[model samples]
Target chain A: MKDRLEIVASGFGGQGVVRLGQTLGEAAVKQGLRVTMLKSHGTEMRGGYVRSQVVLSQKAIDSPMCETPDVFLALSSSAYNRFKDTVPAEGIIVYDPAFVEEIDASLPCRQIAVPAKDIAVRNFKRPIFSNAVALGSLAKLLETMLEKNVVLESFLEVIPKYKDENRNAFEMGYETMNI
Target chain B: MKRFLETGNFAITEGAILGGCRFFCGYPITPATELAEAMSLRLPQVNGVYLQAEDECAAMHLCIGASLGGMKSMTATSGPGFILYADPYGWALGCEAPMVVMNSGRVGPVSGITGAPGQGEFYLTRYPTQGGNFETITLAPNSAQECLKIIVEAFYLSERLRMPITVLGDQLLTDGMEDISVPENDDEMKEMGLRVWPRLYHKGPDFYPASDALDIPPVQMGYDTGALCSDWTPTVEGYDIEEVEEHHKHAYRLIYKVRNNPQLYEDFYEKKYMDDDPDLVVVSYGTPSRVVNTAVERARSEGLKVGALRLINLWPFPDRHFSRKTKYLVVELNWDGQLVREVQRAAPKDAEVKFLGCCGDLPTIPDLMETFTKMLKNQPLERKGWVLEAW
Candidate 1:
């Protein structure tokens, strides 16, 4: 595992952006990693943009701001466009193609298109489970650093209403990434 | 010890309960509203009282009433709500009411930005009330975990000082989430270096003492101690007095009780890389100091002789830390340089003091690193338009 890992998730208010970050942070905490999560939203709660910056470290975390995120989860086009440049060459950008149709092809970072919305709608018939799908892909990407089962357990713990659906959605997401 | 990933508001609520705060009266404001909500949810389980007042003034007054009735009390608000606390703040100070007031500062002259963090209240906390005769004790914690410890310390100080103590925080500190460990019992609390002072009723015919002392229990009205308290200048026996000498005695006790007992809170600061007297000292408080620590550490790695001084005890302004005749840079979360002014006043005449001010957010590390580089190279620090100016 890296000494410090910075993950940022940004999208519209209702896209479960903050929840995604919180789930990852909770998993990191269960793994005994020092974690700090900062969530910020615009004036409006629904339509406005929301962001959550999560920093996980083996040691004490000094700066919580994700100036350069190791992993960038973009659920909205604007978020994809705004933060595309902050990802270093070795960093990865996981974006939902449903919201981010136009991608920045010139960026040095590796960009993966995860059609979470389409997959969730096709399988579960509800777009709300897209977040679970997204977390699954993130879990696969962070498998080397975090345990897949732990991440899945934390996701289920965070959104406990539909445990079976979320588990399936998470597995689908992990399979989609296939890292 | 119980560990959980939670917001600073949750940590503060637990801290207040551990410190014997059984009553909380607050006016809901963004950033601080969550703290009140947490109190409302948890206070009842602990057999404590949580009240939502009509306004901030009424809220602080209610806390004063609770404290007078022999209960450790607390109140919280943001910048806008804290402005309304001027009336009761003076009353609490003059009557020597032991309570805790938390101002989770948001970007504002008046509700400038409800959700964003700012440090506009650096001076407002020192002079929270109208009259300047009394001194106020204020603690600023940078993170959620520190917020827990500081709130507990604030309660301890309030009881000993016999005045309303302010725990100053910012939006980010109160609203941000982090992994926090809370003590499960008194043994664990002591193992974690946490202290708690019980609320003691003054068995007094002379409740208002003229001397500057510590651990003098505050007057409890419900008891048969005949404790008298009011907005007026208090006499030795807690009566209304307008005489200059009696007012002098009251003022001295209010101011000197804290000023004279600097040893209690003087060590409430963090110093990094200052042992060998580095060329530059970065001074800051609250959330911004976290970034400053990182930036300073990075600068040191790059061979820059820089140090960091983080003030946890904000009021009584730790001047002793500024005695070193070195270049000082004060970073704050406000456009106007409030803390920078204090550093200038406290530093030696020959020492150079500068300011880097930002609001509504923490300063980026790259910006801080570039500034440190420029300051070390003796380059002129420039400001773009009105974004952020340097002194």
Candidate 2:
């Protein structure tokens, strides 16, 4: 990261929204960047609105959250709806169209829709790996700041199990370089 | 030597282990549960014992018992659970036992939302227990790295002064993750003066474990040391004493242990861009301090004479930090205004004081930037706290 890149990953509980932020944060740390991540979830464990704020900077990250994010990655429509209008005109939004049904055109930011869950379920038969797919999509969309390979390697390090399947899911989403 | 991306709770667990916390007696609570989980797995690899108590009260007593047996002990809890551990905490103080208590404070009064962050237990960490007046050191670290560093200090301050110490980590910090560097090897730790106090051992045939040296951990209970661990004021021989004059000596030692040694139990603060005597200095701790730091820089870039003082040591009030010529703006994560009251009492009389606080969310950068800008122009504060819409 050059100065500071604020990233927000939002989805329902068990959708691995927090894990996506963590994987990105861990990769940033390994890349010699300062990183801070705060994960918030509702009372419901399964379907609650879950959000993780990841801030990366060349210098120490004083705070993690920003009202206008540099990147917003949404796995669910509720997640996208909750934070759609929050990003600035220069910011970017990477959403998995498999879950996010609607997008606000007035958001005034670059928007890309990736079928991350669809790719995960169709290729690996495991929707749980959708987070890794979404992360790969996000990395590709924000490729100028972060390296796609570095993000994938960090996911491998963070998720100890289901190695081959998770990597495949990330690759499948990474192949969708249309953003 | 190595950097690891870990949560504040994970940092605390490793920090305690590095500081020689061989015994962890804790009851899990939200935001603090992961600390216990990490300890349960990590402690055993280092030949330490991780005991899961039924409740916070029992956890506090268990730590006391372990400390008495010559083990550096710790117990982790949140707001409601910390209250349960209060009475046993008093016992630890009265007996002059050295232990560390981790309070991952949450929104509270009753069983508030466990996920939400708050500095609700700011005062509770210091004077939670009833009875005789005693002083304890409380440390508030803003980052995961600081969490790892201060917990080692927590164990040290507790043992060196022979009293309990509290490390307050709010939910925002505790549950969050950050990149931090910890002492990965013995040499690195040694260079940083990471010392662990060994338990007190009585080698004599008629040895009294709980003698005058109740300050340190007593003899191993299995070794047959005549140690009567009592909450009441005790004699040099470890027996309870009812006399007022004798109690005076005992009480005086306990109360003045950390208070008298100002140099040893001194405060730790962070001052960024305050060299030229700024007109307004934002005072805060824990997670909210991060935003204030950002706001200070934002305000500074705009030619506003603004600075920040992040209080590392919460207790002893760090009254020495505030001075004249520069006014103070107190920021915190609680509605009770605990930090402002301290600022009002300790800061210079001529210094103008302001308060900005919240419970669930932190004081954001934009709100603080505006507040600092208005305060510099002598504009009245729009709201009690720093939220923008309401202000």
Give the Å error, residue A64, model 1: 1.1
| TM-scores of all candidate predictions against the true structure | 0.97, 0.93
> Per-candidate DockQ versus the true complex?
0.71, 0.70
lDDT string for model 1 (A5-28, tens) is 999999999988888888998899
Task: Write candidate 1's Cα lDDT for B1-391 as tens digits.
Answer: 9888888999999999999999999988888878999999999999999999999999999999999998999999999999999999999999999999999988888878876889999999999989688888889999998988999999998888899999999988988889889998888889999985556778776788998989888888865777678888888877787789889999999999999999888889998999989999999999999999999999999999999999999999998899889899999998889999999999999998888889788998888888888888889787655755447
Worst 10 residues of 1 chain A by lDDT: A38-47
The residue pairs in collision within model 2 are none
Query: Compared with the true structure, what per-residue lDDT tens digits does model 2 show for residues B1-391?
Result: 6788889999999899988899999888888989999999999999999999989999999999988778889999999999997799898887767899999878877887777788988788778798746777789989898887789888877776677889998987889999988787778876665654454554333222222333443334446556566766666665676788767777777666666776655646788987888889999988889888888988899999888889888887778777565778888787667888788879877778888878777777778988898899999888753454321
Best-fitting candidate, measured by TM-score?
1
**Candidate 2 deviant stretches above 4 angstroms:** B192-225, B384-391
TM-score for chain A as predicted in candidate 2? 0.93
Q: What tier of docking accuracy does candidate 2 attain?
A: medium
- Per-residue lDDT value at B374 in model 1: 87
Q: For residues A13-80, write the lDDT of model 2, one tens digit per residue.
A: 99988888998898888788888999887667789888899998898788777567888998888889
